[model samples]
Target: MKSLILHTATRLMIGILILFSLFLFFRGHDEPGGGFIGGLVGAGAFTLYAIAFGTDLTRKVLRVDPITLIALGLASLVVSGVIPLITADPFLTGKWLFLEWGNSDIKLSTPLLFDIGVYLCVVGFIVTVIFSLEEEN
Candidate 1:
């Protein structure tokens, strides 16, 4: 069916979009990009697919429920906040870990985790909104 072909192409494009979003996210720390923008891009992919196909089919392909994704994202953000409290630091305090190997040094931080949480939250939340809008129509 024409719809089926369109759906397939849309899904493929969505996959590409998600990959491109991740590329933007990882490259963000060094340049001028990051999770928030990446998350929006990722969500936009799914939303486009949902529009091309239908919410029911999209949900089946996604496997996980959008509501569950929202909950998980929110929980990740809350857990990240609790980490600082547990360590006796103020909430959301940036914590960093450094690793040195030969001539290379790697830096990791709680802020990164927070950004990841924000990314997930934005993706999940926006996807849910888009899906719900589709359902209403």
Candidate 2:
């Protein structure tokens, strides 16, 4: 019962934090932030949740194994990089995606996708670490 409340609160906080972290991440592309810092901030949410609600619950809520998450993240990252390579561009070059909506334009890019992958990677990595630590302790 107590654990349930704590878990709920932490999960809510994690959702909020992940959104904020994404905002920071996307905003930071031109400013002072990027994938790494934002990823860590996002990962912090899961870590706190794990700390409060035990790893089993955290894993259940997450609905994906950490190893699988990490592998997917890595695969996405590799695929993102490969796009440029296939196009005969240098690795890590940014790819822009333009969306036309009525009279407005929505601009997306590979960098954002890469950042998302990084975010997942960081979360999975941290969760794995936290779970291991808890087991050890």
Candidate 3:
């Protein structure tokens, strides 16, 4: 078992890491960061939590199995690519949808969805591998 200080520190760090990961994921479209980096950071947080607590506890905290996450991510990516085909665009062509708000416009695109899928896929794969390895030992 981890000491009280380690457990407390991990609990605090996990929240910060997850928030930062989301920041990286969202800011990726117009900036340098992207899905892969964001996913890595997020997975790292979970890994730390697993280490401080236990793999079973981490899995319980996550609620969803990593394998499910992988499947969903792959499905999302496939759907994102296929969506443009309905408009007669080539594969993976970006489709944009703009939502008008009171004072600002929110832009959504296929590429963003694709990035989200990539993020999910990476995080799921990494976590699954890590946990499986931990369980084996």
Candidate 4:
């Protein structure tokens, strides 16, 4: 049975949850909250939706297969590791890149890439398990 209130509230909360997940992800590099927690929160958002609606609807909202997320995450991790080796740095060494756009300077780093990979993997794994469990029922 679907609760109309739950479906409506979940639709609203999903966006907020995703936004907060990103905030946590960005803050992770320098602060305490990193990819792991961010990904968990992200996965929780989907899980909540699945409960309110159904796993099939959640999958449609996801747009891509969970396995694809895992694949991309792994690839990103490998690339982050290999990038340092290309410069003769130790494996998994942090690399920094700076970009200037007009008056704004953007700092990019390998660690952030690695974190992104972690986030994707965590979200993918959790979602896959949840979907599978739902399908079994």
Candidate 5:
């Protein structure tokens, strides 16, 4: 049994949740929020959608399999750690690259990549569990 209002509300809420999760992910490096929390929020959004509109539809919306996300996340994390080794730095050392646009400088680091990896890994794990459980029921 599905309520039209629930389905409509879920559609709007999902986008907001995903956007907020991204915000949390990006702000994590400087502030309190981080990949783990962001991923949890993201997974929550999807789970909400799954609950509102069957797991099959949720899976279809995702397009890519959760397994793939998990693999990519692991690979990203490993690569972030390995990149420092190539530059004679210790494993997982914070490596920074500065980009100059106009007068402001933008700093990018391996930790950000690691955070992204963590985010993906968590989201994948949660979604997989949710879908599996939902299917069983």
Candidate 6:
């Protein structure tokens, strides 16, 4: 059975969940939160949506295959490791780049890239599993 309240609440909450997940992802490299937690939260949001609706709608909403997310995420992970090798550093050594933007400096690091890859992989793997289980039901 369909639920009016659930549908309405899900429509509102999904965006909030995704935004919050990003917040965690950004703060992770420095603080307690990180890619793994962010991805779990993100996957939970979609899983909630799947439960309220169905797997078909969930797939449509995603707009891309979960496998694609996994592939890209793996590529990101590999690239993060390879970046240090190019500079003659040990594998997976943290590298930082500073970019000046309008009198402010932005710091980018390979660890963050690795974390992002983890985030994508977690989300993709969980969602794929959830979709499979939901479909089988």
Report every candidate's CA lDDT: 0.80, 0.80, 0.93, 0.92, 0.92, 0.91
Give the deviation of candidate 3 from the true structure as CA RMSD. 0.9
Model 1 misses residue 39 by how many Å?
0.9
TM-score of every model versus the real structure: 0.82, 0.81, 0.96, 0.94, 0.94, 0.94
Which residue pairs collide, candidate 6? Answer: 28-33
Instruction: List candidate 3 segments past 4 Å from native.
Output: none
Best by lDDT: 3
TM-score of 5: 0.94
User: Clash number for model 3?
Assistant: 0
**Candidate 6: how large is its RMSD?**
1.2
Name the top TM-score candidate: 3
Off by over 4 Å in 2: 1-12, 102-104
Residue-level lDDT of model 2, residues 1-137, one tens digit each, is 25877767886788898888888787776788777788788778778877887778878877999877788889888878778887899998999889999999777887877877887788778878888888786
**RMSD over all Cα atoms, model 4:** 1.2
Error of 3 at 122 (Å): 0.7
Regions of candidate 4 where Cα sits further than 4 Å from its true position: 102-104
lDDT of 4 by residue, 17-54 (tens): 99999999999878889999999999999999888989
Candidate 1 structure quality by residue, lDDT tens digits, 1-137: 14877778886798899898898877777787688888899888888778887788778876888778777777777777778887899987877889998999877877677678777878888889988877896
Cα distance off (Å), candidate 2, residue 84: 1.6
lDDT of 3: 0.93
Clashes of 1: 0
lDDT for each residue of candidate 6 in 75-98, tens digit (9 for 90 to 100): 999999999999899999999998
The weakest ten consecutive residues by lDDT in model 5 span 1-10
